[model samples]
Target: MDSTRILIGASSAPRDGWLHLDHGATSEVDRRPSTDPSTESVPTGRTQRVEAKGELDRADAASVRVALAEWRRWMAPGGELRFDLPDAGAALAALLDPASSPSACDGAETALRARADGALWTAARIERELESAGFDGSRVRVDGGRLVARAFVATSTSPSNSGMATDPTSSAPDGAARDESNTAPSAASHTAPTVDAPTRVLVWCGGGERERLRDLLATYGRVLTNRSDLELLCVFDGRATTAAAFTEAAGAAFAATLGTAHGLRLGCVALPEDAAGLEALRAAAAIRIAIHDEPLQLACLDLAGHVDPARLARAIGGGITEPANGALDDELVRAASDLHPWFYPVELAGHRVVPGLGSPCTPQYLESRTAHRRQMLVDAVLERVDMRGRRLLDLACNCAYWTSAWARAGASELFGLEGRPEHVAQARLHWSSNDFLPEGAWRFEQGDIANAADWKTIRDHGPFDVTLCAGILYHVRNYEEILRWAVQQTREVLVVDTRVQDGDEVLIDEPGDLRFNAIESTRRKVVPNRARLIAVLEELGLSCEVLDVPFGTALGVDHDDDYAAGRRITIVARKVRSALPSARLGTSSTDLR
Candidate 1:
């Protein structure tokens, strides 16, 4: 009764002030008091706000009815209950929509199959169920392919719910009448949404390193290609040389690599390497790149010099220290000294870990990208294959970000195999730092997926329910062998997220560098087009479909252009009991092009 807010199924990232509870023992909340159903019922009549996201659809009709009754009983007068469920009605409509793309229909079908466990609830049916559970006012509507509902407990001044019936066409709650054509209830009114700020890169050039400057510019050029929103500012020491000298060298490098400095919003300014210069640099960017004779130093700086341990933990894996008198913490600076720049932002300790600057894959951008990918996977594969009590294999799971995500989604057992030992160590560090997963529930092993001997180590883990091959397919030349191994090890579903070409298979050869998180060269890899990738999966006895990217002006996060341009894709392939129909080129039912 002390807490006024309750968030069910908060997964890994539970809010600070809210009372969090999830279904299984994997979450930290499950260890707390009153979490066990056999011990005690949830405290009633005190919570002012309650939210159950993606939880109601996991239970049957009776269980959902009971849960609604319990929620109603637990709410104080005027308390609000908001929840979202997979919208079966929306999926069915999309399936019937002639204008819906083939990928959309495939996604719709996948969603429908996922909710076939008698947990499907349309908007009207959910509103009626809420009214039956003694809610005075309730509103249900579709948002982001889910049935978002809001119900309120009646207060003394509010109308009684005794004989009220919910209108199927109405947007208002019971005992209230509102125009249906008007705007629907604001779903995000209660929560403060995270704003995705633009990514700014501060390039600190110490001078006298032409090759280093060229290399840095080349790296940024590759990372920031097709990304126009990111800003790159090169700050040079005024004492070292004239601003013009630094600008000239940098301009030549930028021109050679990036084609032009103007396209990248690249600029150069002279500043002394003192407190004033640091302040100026701080005002300009969040991520800083220090170019020196030694290896490049990448660190995220807090402009205010505010020392937050959690943020430090997220930025660097560990090394928390207290800064004195609002000064920049020396320990934090030292920790970031050895850190390699991250191409993909990894979520650690509830915040995203973005080690480098101006990659277009900032913490916010990657967070949005991850959410979009997760939603697509849910609609395509996860909705049908429940993660609960299932085993997951993450092949080439760099730092185990997706592995941890599956654990949060209720996968009982997780095994992550990566090519780099450093990444394996990082995966272990992530698991140790986070308390969402129980001990012995997950394991991280270091191995190359391209090695046949490594497959022996992976096979020892046995057949897995779900196999994840994200960010690995386009990096290997022997992709067929990898796919066969994944299919042989997977029992139900295999989710693959990779970069694909448009036409014939293309081979790209790039340097194999640990800094880029590429253990192998692109020369040893083949970037298969979308059609070829699907055909291979279908040949392996799995039905495959390319998941649609949700790209629109309404989305706040800046997604990478590769996704929008169909150069990158996420395909979910499910194992079939019988052989899949031989899908000829351009003739497959799942051809999304």
Candidate 2:
């Protein structure tokens, strides 16, 4: 039996059968450690394992990736690698607790202090790093107050050193090597269901392999013994599962459609051959599935809507068959079908199998009017507020379009407050889909901004450097009061984007002019003219200026060439800390507000 060669960092020792490479020089270990591409620490094609217990937090992303790549190169056909670090949230809790040991608390404080200093790791970041470093079957968990991750080398010859190795031709029992060829598990497609219907089983197999595929599925049916009632929805890849094939397979048991001409029909696979077909299934599928021989893409669209990270971690830890809770697979198709038409189409992992939650802000078809507004907001902030390392507040963050923009621009910390739970979920979904902010840098909390208690919760998180009150000012009746609170909370800049009342005469306490809502509600409370907004900011000891962008950049009651029909404006207000040499507005030494 070959012994496991281990590359352990730090003085903390492990159990027997492990080799610890603890060089006396700490500087060499700190700079290179496990990720030296040229270092031939171990013999070629020899299986090696690594265990970095509580040390990853000390290393940078580039170093970590290099270490993992080196490990992959050294790993034989079936080698394993694992690492663990203190969870940032758990570390903070430990730091705040009086019962924790002084040393433990010190360690926790150090990790969090590094996080505060802009060095941190998120689950998403970890996953991306591992994948980019050539590791497959990546599993991450926040267990027992620590972040643990395990992965294996993925190559053409040896796809994974973990999980049941799958092969198309063989019925390899428990330990037999199997082929995980085209299948890459991607269940993260978070969109509200637009239609409710029964579950459909989509199968894609070649012409000659239809019978073999049926046999293979029968084996799967036995595995899913209790789930035999699921309706079979078959879509052949190319001419593989042809119409004649369907006629022979089940006769009238399946309805064979040529393509996805009709949007989301019962028991149909919308083949992505044309524009109509692609658009039809873009945001319509309740569930998407592929068989073994075909592309190994399967999305439990039902599970994608509200992903609990803990539960998702458990599901991924367990194989594809095992969900964290037993109830996840119970008639999910029906539940997904009942969802309200998603605000917009959302694509999963950029795959054609399932579309994204396509909403007006991040639309698939149009010119993305939401992107234009976000750019305008970014431009206004970059002009006055120094975004680098600043804390930001995003009020009424519907799907966090502006909040994400701030994080991308280098805001150190971000807090987004949204009234709706669904919108918050969408924001989280977007974060999971993209890498806009580092982990633990931004948080989106569900709360009605109009409520005092919720406002207090937001206040506890602030004294923020910049506050954004865009598209939300006109929704509340107490618009002036909201502006007053915003000025008080913000330390430096307050940006406002909304429709201004027509004419030079300043208007105040005016009712909403039916811009965002078709029917009037408490939400459609007030719309103040541009001058009144500027005056309120000035009264709060902040110098105000109206930032100008191109017309039609934002959506409003009217965005045409005519200014008399009301236009959207972006207002920037900066707290005058000291009198400038030029002495503008509230900052003039002669006046001094």
Candidate 3:
């Protein structure tokens, strides 16, 4: 009932209301009276997220089962329980054979052994135990020497609660109280989300030194010859410049420079004031990089969306001044930080592309977790089929990573389709540029995967030799429809890479057996097991072969049949053959090559 968090573990220092339970106190915890008059009972179907770390590894299976039951009771509907346990194989080896090698019993194992409950814990066993304790969407994976498990506590009623809890104290008891200020805007202009970054950034310099300075910085971005669509707008409020005068001058320059060449709408309006005006502009432009020319106040609107206040404060705390050499280093940094949400978290300047968002997907950020998997998929596809001078279609192509790779592997023509316009723009700016692919070798289009018009466009592009459907099947709701369309579009091979359930039997029309909503994002994603997937592919007049490469194994992850239900699978479905040949489908490395 109180928003205050309650912690129960073996921590030395204890905070207010935190019941720090040790190994000795756990018995008391188990034996405590169910009906306690002193404490207010948590509302039924209230959302509770229980996170247990380190301590679960030291506890026995029975103790864990008891803890799970207690946590489930405390959880409201749609509540989650996450735990981290010691790896059974690694920990047992360390405890039982302590003198064998100290390497086996590392710091975590040795420490946990001191308080060991003597119950070995494997990823699979942990998942089974969690499920037996009445939890849905149980996902357990091994990271390092620890087995991590996460699942939502199963509710008695159907999941119609919308996962929103209602406070009994509030007058409006339908759901939780929301801030009135966050209501939808009265103006239609304020409804649109922030537009993607523009192809070009144009600045109306009131002549002289500022004009030359504009030229220096304009090369860094797409600096539009004419206003196409306003992603970024800069108004010069100089010593003698007015907002009206700046707009007029910029319009004239745009007309004279690249008139009629531009097709997109250019948002060139006077600076806005007030919440509605600011929201309208913020929604329209990725950011309003207001660079002042002294005597100007610093007041930027906080949408509280993706841009963090702390990060923004650190970036724009001090005003940036052009260096003596006229380099816009400081200005660029400020702009980069401001446009961080718009950029694809990667800087593609010259031949080098560096990470901007610092996520695992980019090599500059983390060690590229999917690099090996991607490479394996590419290698597997190339080994079985020859793609030289062939046309290819890449579905759900994120920034044309696979498109470019396929091109390099000898695909003469490529068409990559993505749902996000931002990704399409980035793909055009980086991969499809003249420096990377030849003028007409590859093209990237933005369209919804579920849309028939997008499939028609792909169909118009001609029957592609190989249709690479990777990292996409699981995100979409109507995957069968899309897959059917993809089969109609592919000429020879259809490379399917996605997550599938680890089971011998395929799941079809099994209502209540699988979660209607994905555990991760509540999005409807059906993960078919190997058998179901192969059967579906075969039904579509294609023979399927599962690649030999172990899925998600390189990143110290084991894709075993355990706590985690979904495992990454790469299946090469051939349209020519009705069934996979024995030589091609076998597990031998020689057969794969």
Candidate 4:
């Protein structure tokens, strides 16, 4: 049997080692014998690969079905098909864009309307058609205003060959021959052939000094030039007293700083103080900011409150720099003062907090503890999970140290729930000073974990991709409830860091507050044995594993003695096989600090 490689809708001259087919009357490949299954009989199960370009969009629904069926029939077991078609959605979007010229808009409209019988060929529609045509799996994505798709024929012999063509002569769309030695393509490569750049939406509220705004814009403009994928949307609060003036000043600042280079990717809007308007803005925004104005900060918070907590994760409270006059108001000054000292020494804007009078531990101790715990979590759990676009929940998030760390690590949305209002304020201050995330992508809420009502509020914000119950489980009297809540809220993984007893018995100490007292009430500490903790987590449908602690000397710094003695352990619990996808359970190693 001859191995066939077919290229349909070839607009150019045919290359060696492949068969080319086209229906165009003036095409160079028109001289070849017709392989149209409808008109002429073609051998089935002989083709190793098939690539079609610009043919599907010109076919009606019935014709598309027939063509797909014929192509799949021709494909051998473990064969593949790749194709590209005009993206109807992209065409429509191009027509809708106000920046598009009249001629360009007309051309897009004409191309879309010219489709066979006014039929539209979208990526999603093509995927469905491919699936119906008996392909084992199919994927479609928009690329340069066109839909590129790949489909595979299923094989029952070996799982390795399930979605890969065996023939060595099979070539990619770019005419490169396939390497027969390579393993099957990864699921991600097939499912998400193209990875679109993540958009960072920046919502700036309240006007600043024109010079200050210009300086800020100048800094951002330089950053934007290098990051074409990042978009900047400056939404000035229309409710502010200086709304019109601020807007005008901002426009001038943008022009002076960025000029025409970033005009297409940057936009400034002044939205009215209506709920509908705010809601619309929130729907499109990934971050929100209020700069140097306490009233504006409060207003931004109020606006953020209306959004679903799960959706409103990232927010910035103030501008990056402190005011020159040094006459900061009460709330701003207090938040900046580190009113509720952070248990972990969180560094923001190149400044690390010094251990103040009420600090529980020395700066060295805090740094060592934070580094050790963070390294353990990353190696045992975080490395396994894809944090790029995942939602994260940080319980008892004092000063949001872990929350801020995860945000920088690439968690798209972050919700840090802490019992202390002062810590929440400090968390806001930390983000404001750093200006690391876009506003509306992170939020620090004050909520008591022990309260069921607070749990209800947290539930509304979930189900989270990852939940961190660090240093709080052992502190709370209701350890079981906390575990259950953490497990219930988490969809993929739950990380617990707590003091564990060496003995089998679960011990409950007398009501006491630790040196780093962030809890509101003096609750008895419930320390469970390692086995009990693992068993409970297993019962909650999680596969739990204790993370290994680095040797005392290997830690590079003096960490707490409890970790070296195995009294304090970090447990990474992932949902059982039945609960999560098998792919997510794959073991991966990450470097330790």
Q: How well does each candidate superpose onto the true structure, as a TM-score?
A: 0.42, 0.37, 0.38, 0.40
Q: Model 1's lDDT to the true fold?
A: 0.55
Q: List the residue pairs that clash in candidate 1.
A: 114-383
Regions more than 4 Å wrong, model 2: 1-367, 503-521, 551-566, 577-593
- What CA RMSD would you report for each candidate? 28.2, 24.9, 25.2, 25.3
The alpha-carbon lDDT assigned to residue 127 of candidate 3 equals 50
- The lDDT per prediction is 0.55, 0.47, 0.46, 0.54
Q: Please name the candidate that would achieve the greatest lDDT relative to the true structure.
A: 1
Residue 524 lDDT in model 1? 55
Task: Tell me the spans in candidate 4 whose CA falls farther than 4 Å from its real position.
Answer: 1-334, 338-340, 504-515, 518-522, 553-561, 577-593
Tens digits of per-residue lDDT for model 1, 1-593: 23477777745356666666666312333522233232234566887988888776557667788778877877998799998776654554454444668897666555444221234354435655786887765655445567677888755332211111112111111221111211211211112212332344545555624543444454333333334444455655566666567766665554433332124555555543455545544444443323221212334433232223223222222211122222444443333323333434453443334333222112223333455555555555665567888898989887676667667778888888988776777677667657647879888898888766678777888689999898777777767667877887889988988777766765544332223334643235677677878877888789886777766311112222256667668887889964344433223322211
Instruction: Tell me which of candidates 2 and 4 scores higher on TM-score.
Output: 4
Give me the candidate number with maximum TM-score.
1
> Ranking under lDDT, best-scoring first?
1, 4, 2, 3
Order candidates by TM-score, high to low: 1, 4, 3, 2
501-547, model 3: which lDDT tens digit per residue?
64543222222222321222214445556676777677767988877
lDDT of 4 by residue, 1-593 (tens): 12377767747455455666666312333434333322233468988888777766556667777888888888888789988776644554454344667786565554444221324454435655676787765655445567677888755322220011211112101211112211222112222112342243343434435544443454333233334444445555455535457655655555443333233244455643565655544444432322212212212222222222111110001111223232334344334533533555554554334322122122224444456666776654656666777799989887777656667778888888888777787777778767557888778888888665678767878889989888776666667667776777888888888767757554344322232542535244456667877767777689887878764522212222256677678887889743332232222231010
